[model samples]
Target: MENKQLLEIAEQAKENAYVPYSNFHVGAALITKSGKVYTGCNIECASYGGTNCAERTAIFKAVSEGDKDIEAIAIASDNSSKNEITAPCGICRQVIAEFALDIKIILGYSKGDIKEFKIKDLLPHSFTGNDLI
Candidate 1:
């Protein structure tokens, strides 16, 4: 899908985020190579370590459905300030690298600013599945 449309999906998903802890709502949308899209929102748990980021949630949902060939992902957050924090977390980067290191990651802001990047761009020199053999 186009970046514009992907941003929209991410923004829509952001509305569903369940973040009672930090109040930082985040959303993610994953698009498989077969033209299927899956959306996810950040789910926070009482146990801080159990919290799941929106990016991984979306990718995992796609994987659970037997679709591992993810082509792209879109991420959106409610934060609108331009503070150079429009990026996924380290754990989320590892999760995306496991399936497809070349996947496109689109970052969206609540203020309509968007950025598109490849997984490798965000996490260069990252360890991948092939390295764990």
Candidate 2:
């Protein structure tokens, strides 16, 4: 599927975010190598530590379903400007690296205004599982 289509899904998914604390709603759509798509929204918690990011939510869903060959993921948020397109947080980035090293990350913006990047570009010289072993 096209990146724009995936982004559109993410845009719609953001409507389900449960962010009472930050009010920063975010959504993500992850597509696997087999073309299956999983969608997630940022789920905030009162304790904050229980909060889960949209990217990780989607990725975890895919992995749990035994679909770890991630092809790409698109993220969308309530950013009104192109300059503020949402990017994955640090924890989300590491989770993505654990599943896919060559995944494409799409930053969705006001329709048609999107940015794409390789996961490596987002987390340069990343510390992967290999570092631990």
Please write out the lDDT profile of model 2 over residues 55-93, one tens digit for every residue. Answer: 999988988899999999999998823546888999999
Error in Å for residue 4 of model 1? 1.0
Kindly give the stretch of ten consecutive residues in candidate 1 with the minimal lDDT sum.
78-87
TM-score of candidate 1 relative to the true fold: 0.92
Itemize residue pairs with steric clashes in candidate 1.
none
Model 1, span 12-125: residue lDDT tens: 988899999999988889899999999999999999999999999999899999999999998878763442335789999989988877999987664566778899989999
Give me the displacement of residue 79 in model 1, in angstroms: 1.5
Give TM per candidate. 0.92, 0.94
Question: Any runs in candidate 1 off by more than 4 Å, and if so which?
Answer: 80-85
- Per-residue error for 51 in candidate 2, Å, reads 0.3
